[model samples]
Target: MPAEADPASIDAGAALADRGHGHRNEGLAKLAVGAIGIVFGDIGTSPIYAFRETFAGHHQLTPDGLHIYGVLSLVFWSMMLVVSIKYVTIIMRADNKGEGGSLALLALINRVSGNKRWTAPIVLLGVFATALFYGDSMITPAISVLSAVEGITTVEKDFAPFVLPLAMGILAGLFAIQSRGTEKVGQLFGPIMLVYFVTIAVLGIVHIAADPGILIALNPWYAIQFFLSDGLTAFLALGSVVLAVTGAEALYADMGHFGRNPIRVSWLFFVLPALMLNYLGQGAMILSLTPADAAVAIQNPFFLLAPESLRLPLVILATLATVIASQAVISGAFSVTQQAIQLGFMPRLRITHTSASAAGQIYIPVMNWGLMVMVMVLVLSFQTSSNLAAAYGIAVTGAMLIDTCLLAVVLFNLWKWNRFAAMAMLGIFFAIDFAYFGANLTKVPDGGWFPLMIGLIAFTLLTTWAKGRQLMMARMREAAMPISIFVDSAANSATRVPGTAVFMTSSPDGVPHALLHNLKHNKVLHERVILLTVKIADEPFVEQETRCKLEDLGQGFHRLIIRYGFMQEPDVPEALKRLTGCGPAFKMMDTSFFLARQTLLPSSRPGMAIWREKLFAWMLRNAESAMEFFRLPTNRVVELGSQVEI
Candidate 1:
């Protein structure tokens, strides 16, 4: 027999494996707890207004047993089908290298699709979905905080006058604290949300016990009976029922932060059960009341779930949860903006890293202030969460529909799932998405116009920026000299200075504009010349060992390409330090970085409309400079300006 393994060694090996597996499970548990705090806050807070709005909203309905059970049935099945099956089970699996979002997913699909005929349309859909998110971001904070503060009126009728001012003050404070980072505040999120979810679940259990018949709504027939009994009213009620699942997309968008299993665990085991329990209790409470009493209670069913003594405390807790919900959406806006800039869909803006330890903790000043102003305007204009509710579902439903479209591409093209199985699944998604979107369209005259207007404006800006950047790059490439010719001619003709000169270019194959300009003006070349190009890959991150691609073009000229992920911020100086084989080590004092500043001269070219061209030029002018964005030293930088028409 071959030499047998030592018994003690084998036992030790098995014990080590067991220890490693235990650690992984422990880590996943911790992440799941954290996900309950951050990822579920948006949907968790929906119970505060979702059920009440369905009966007392713009198209009000009577709170009779038929309507009550039917609406509850719709809410439960909607979450199970939309939030549970579609997002948690299926879409979460389409993560791009463990990252998920509209832009992240688009990049992944674009890379895999190659140059197929359908690629361009798919990109437009992704960009439009991102644009619609800006509208959603502005409305979330406005409506969440407003609904929470309005609970004060439920506590004391006299407190009604102060609601608007108090809500505005709290919102101002929340936005004010954004520049100071949220790492410390973020630590308390999980525990507080856990308490909120448990409290709501207990409140539901108490009411649900009193009228257990309300649990019969869990059957799907009640939902079908709802539509068949009153088709038109039920169709319009969809606009409001959709609110219960408003933040369902957060599960997929935030999957990168906390992995799929943890978010799934938080939803399946903790968050979803708590949300449905509260909805059921709300329905049960209405059914147990007299007609006149139900009418008054339906005005604020969420707070009335508690006894008189506890309502005030519950109001405070709900307000805090709403604030936390607002914070998550605001931070999401910053992340999406960063991704847009890196992928060339938008111009660069200043990004400040709030935490030294966490790369994802970023603050964008422009986005923060802009959102604050729009939110304040909305709160003032709408005056009540009921009114804001009319403006909400359009953006959310539109994005959901677009996501379904993108999922079609993923199923048939990327994953190559079974055709019949995929089609059946997609059919359910499309039908649900269309019903909600169509219902929301009926509210356009009553405040739904707000998000649609915002979406249209945002989509125009996003598409214009993307098209302008593409045209500008193509024009520059057409005029660029071949790198091989430039190296041979410049190496023999110019004076060789002592230090290294690094010229930044967008393309790896062409000679940079700054290099040509420096040659004509300065009449000298450094001994070590580097043509550096930074390429952002179609993924969330690139490994360190594969980041730098160095090619020596002979005659002391080297072409360096540094690859980064869309989620990463580019630090040119730091990346250069890790690079070797191009020559001597880089030193800040000795090395000079040359950048080209392009001034757009918009002409009647066959590219974009005159109006869009003007808008693109204005955007380019206001963009943050490359030196700050790339983390370059101010002292050792030279900028050469050139004019280009697109």
Candidate 2:
């Protein structure tokens, strides 16, 4: 009754299906492993300090049964609610063409909102969130590595003096290796983290077996009873409990690097289980000790989970794990900075691609060194991980709050969720975020000001650069001459040369100032004149087919618009090679690229304050040359300077 297919066709269809399944399996495996190394590293390393600091930190808590149970419950719920449900399940879906992070999310929201009055406030929130990330970037490396190295004190009292110097050396070495890139380093991260996670889980299980009653902390009633019984003490404990989810934002930020599925799988299957087991195990271990011994154990329960003989080995493993954690945030900083530059929020800086196969693997010298110096200063200033803990939670909590706000926008405007449902979800997230933020605010006198100060400075710089560029573009457009008018007036009268000339401009319809200056001073035009404009899109990567658009203005004059995503670096030479039907084929040696270099003269402009204007002038003066930023052939490029007052 059924029609039989041809044997060859059936075999081919089965083979094709097999190959498709095989590729999907292989891709998923690779992404999951990679996600372990980078996406989960920060949160993975949190157990080292999160448990220890909750009892012995600046806001010290008594190591009684109620307190221990309550704290463990908070940690569990925080990870489940803030990281698992919110980021992994919800916020990650708000990606901008597969890219995630505050900037990418902002671009997505901005694109969907069109031109609403609320857009500006939303943009400011995103910018401030980005500014706070720099502070987190600097502090994560310092605090994580320091906490790992401090494990030495638990091994032997004599090693106490060596903690600071050893941490500094390890951190210094970590920063030193960044210039060489992370391809080789990244290979070891996944395997090492796997071992670390399994080891911690085993450690937790060993102790949990001794005090099976500790498992009761998994019940939400413990957390509720905690708030009811303890009042203000429990309220303030939220700050220390917040550490359990510090690197949660990295889950969303790194979605583009490894897709949503792998990250979610890795977290749900491996990372989350290991973390909960370890925190629960530490709580169980403390419960088994006598009051005096429990007090001593509370000071460094993470490292003490091991036998005396294995302590040193555990410290070594932890140090490696923390280094991997630091690497994740460092790489994130480079990615975010690149996005900002592409999005026109910052001035151009030197960026080097480390892996030819992976465009996302990059090294930025200025950002790397700047982070290293600040990290070192934090180590010296805080002097201990316990002290640094005071400064940690504020930035993370602030970013989390901002993310919730942005997610509300996406839910209402993009996802078209019911208004009541969206608001209900937002209300839950806001309450938790606000509670944690308020708890951290109490830490300002005890070193929390560090992140706040850094945030303020970064926010000022980011806003100033964005506003300055906007004003400069407006001023340039006022003086810009239409390309049609320029060509009609001078096409025949100007003497012609033999080679090709490419003029880079912000406005596609206008002749570039560099072109006007070149024609005025040299009194000659090239045989093939191309007016080129590079536009950055809201997405991460544009397809090759739609990358370039060409127009023939007649009489050997052409207009070309090349588009790139905010996550990409523009290469003028490579883009030109893809252009067709635009006069002659491009040869690097035969083509000369023309760029305009503006010299800012600060005036009493209505746009920005005098100080900000001066600051913008300094930043503009120090920005990398366009030839280098665009990856143009340096020898075949010409820069024409002009003065602009804004």
Where model 1 places Cα greater than 4 Å from the true spot, the runs are: 1-26
Please list the residue runs of candidate 2 whose C-alpha ends up more than 4 Å from where it truly belongs after superposition.
1-25
How well does candidate 1 score on lDDT at residue 522?
A: 95
lDDT tens digits, residue span 206-276, model 1 = 99999999899898888889889999999999999999998888888887777777888899999999998
> What is candidate 1's local distance difference test score?
0.90
- How many clashes in each structure? 0, 0
- In order of appearance, the predictions have TM-scores of 0.96, 0.96
Could you tell me the lDDT of residue 186 within candidate 1?
94
